[model samples]
Target: MPSRSRYDVVIVGGGHNGLVAAAYLAGAGRRVAVLERLDAAGGAAVSGTPFPGVAARLSRFAYLVSLLPRRVVQDLGLRLELRRRPFASYTPTVRDGAPTGLLVGDGEERVRTSFTRLTGDEREYVAWRAFYARTGRLAGRVFPTLTEPLPSRAELRARVADEAVWSAVFERPLGETVEETFADDLVRGVVLTDALIGTFAHAHDPSLAQNRCFLYHVIGQGSGDWDVPVGGMGAVTGALLEAAVAAGAEIATGHEVTGIATDGRGAEVAWRTDAGEGVLGAGTVLVNASPSELARLLGEPGPPAPEGSQLKVNMLLRRLPALRDPAVDPREAFAGTFHVAEGYAELETAYREAAAGRPPTVPPSEVYCHSLTDPTILSPALAADGYHTMTLFGLHTPARLFSGDPADRERTRERLVADALAALDTHLAEPLADCLAVDADGRPCLEVRTPGDLEDELRLPGGHIFHGDLAFPHRAEEGEPADQAERWGVATGHRNVLLCGAGAVRGGGVSGVGGHNAAMAVLGR
Candidate 1:
């Protein structure tokens, strides 16, 4: 049945952010409704058993959780858990006859030994740690501000309080910073990769979108760690759903919100459910949709269509692949982020090619074996069989490259996947394809998500994962509600409707900053 035709707040899009907002608002004793277009919630933070006759549930889209705030978890009393990976990353040079490249974490001696090859001395490694130490401090200062009223950029820079740190990160191009800081080209490329993950810009793009993206990737929980959720990505969302329901939030799945209007008086939402169309009246509307989608719902012009530049590949490996470096076990190499063909110079080359209307010749991507860190993701049968799930996030392959006719798009996807797999082969002792788990159909258990695929699946405008290019977290002006400094930074130019999704300020990842901020904005907290 439909909700009471009215609510204190109607949250459109039952993504994790929406659910977070619903929980906060409902917990405050407000009547709330969360309408999800899909039959279930979670958005990209979902898990599913993609392979038939196989019981392993793969975290379909997003595979890691880092930005979710500890405060939110504690405040909501969520039982969600996240497991840390001891090995941070291993970069495998695709060059033949070259060693297995570099791996960070595991042991300080091994990591320092790897760094000596790149740094030639401890000076460079010292500099690397110093650089992140400064950024880590900055992350600590900035993360707490995310859910509060917008702070001026000057205030934020002042809070960090170091001119050199501010200039190197916020002012100088990230490319220049990495080049100046790291002596090794591959090491520099590894640092810059964080800047380019899903961003389509070069490290030196004048817009500094790369810098912002890099900052977000590095500054999670003030530790710069991207941890694996205890179960899968679904665990985070499942907990959010649980918290919201416990707080008296009504969630209606399969309810696709189609229209929204807001005035000084209140907000109205129209949706298409399985039964029929319905309109909801609410004192306020919290939108978990992308900014472009929200703009369309509000009958306004959307931003320039954003584009997603990543190709994600998910596979169930029959067993861990053999590593080229005999000294390092496959368990340690694959546990954290595994990089392939991601040397700095190569990254630049791939970015230039993709920018020049082509997919990367050597497709730069990262892979991680999730089961290595958390065995709970696998069923007992699969666990006994030594099967593990791996996720690959391919960078710089823009959506525009797949913009041709249908057949051409498919061809591009196939070529990209083939090239990516071929690159991953360079670091393995044996071909990775040989280790792929066979599905019921006798085919390899694999799935590739192109930028177009993300668009179709998640309604991510242009498949842009962060909704759009990340904007600076603060408003330009200081201390003025009229100037947007006093708003929770969730305001959508609508008095009573606000954005609580990746498009909102400080929004992205599985973080509920937008959700928390929106609720705070409504509650005058």
Candidate 2:
């Protein structure tokens, strides 16, 4: 028999978003509890001793922290722990023995130059920045109101009508947007690459214009600095958990939520822990799992299924091979991150192949070598020996495992690893195999979550990470009441139950807008 306890609210999932919601609700004088299936609270934003004596972050799944709102950190007083380093990235253009045109930078100069090199048009870089600047200002205005009910269409159009904002929002595909603005193919590819990061769409695709909006929503302003915290990405989650604890929020790890019991008054959440089945009732429930996961919790009688993209792989690496770009100084090599796909055409082709349920020969890979910037992440002993840890995000692999007998899936996993290594090899002269420490064997470091699995297990529709796409209709345009209910934020179709995971309007990443906004909504703030 499980002990029955009551609370003002019960938050499911100890992911960053869930912890953020718990902290805010607890701060506001509510008795709250947080339950996590995993023993730890960070979810994807977690770090572990995958290898002995190695403290490398598992940043492969969720790399970079710049997209996180500064306001959220400040409001929560996590400044000291959430350290920021300069943004760094490099692409070495070497042909034969000579250097072609290596691109590198740390601030707006980097953003501008990266785009300029891609399209060969400085004007295009200017337009892109101007567009991003205006969008940032608009986000500042609109995002604050996200916790409230959706806005009106008139308000959305009025905000979008601003000449600068309108151009970026409606008139451009990220590829064409950059192409029209710049003449450099390299710059165009690099700048537009941001628009396609986690999506199955191509840079040149018409639907990509909305992706640009979502991209800018994350790419903060000024210097374009995407820094990692000191200890590791997990530090951010640790701070949130600390805040929650300080606010008197109770947390239980290794406890899996099995179902949600709803009634006129509120919801009764059931879970299976080490002890046994446990249930807690609350006036409001905030779910941090995917929409499909939530649906499973509600059984067959809950809200309609959610629709969105699913996350594929999250691999941790020991070391990244040294990439030498003659145009870049050795010191500047670690300044930012790198996009490995050669150009827009390659990117589009790769996405097309993946969409057909086939893994692309050349998958789009995003590499983040955080240890180069954050010394703390390096093991103290290894730091003395000068060994650096890197995170290679082999994103957008085919959702389906290769079809075959049991042995085929195993071979498929090997092929996926080979594909990832091959992609890295093509970009850098010295591939990861040369500097390798840990190799992915057996199952994939992380398998792609199927839509059915997302619904049945994680409870996310389409296994989409953002709950839903962060495009125009989903955002309900600029002035409209934010129709992110499907995304799973503060607003739920139900009266008291609220959504607070990456599935919400602001959407995924380490940002806590989903949770913070939900808290405010619950308090009717």
| Best-matching candidate per TM-score | 1
For all predicted structures, in order, the TM-scores are: 0.97, 0.83
Q: Name the 10 consecutive residues with the lowest summed lDDT in model 2.
A: 442-451
Global lDDT of model 1: 0.86
Cα lDDT, model 1, residue 280: 89
For candidate 1, give the lDDT of residue 486.
Answer: 41
Per-residue lDDT tens digits for candidate 2, residues 142-238, read 5544444544545554645565554555456656556566564554555655665444456656766445445544445323446677777677888
Candidate 1 regions exceeding 4 Å error are 94-97, 117-120, 483-486
Model 2 alpha-carbon miss at residue 136, Å:
5.2
lDDT of each: 0.86, 0.61
Model 2 lDDT vs. the true structure?
A: 0.61
lDDT per residue for candidate 1 within 38-117, as digits (tens), equals 99999999999888888888999998987888989999999898988989988765334657467799677878887766
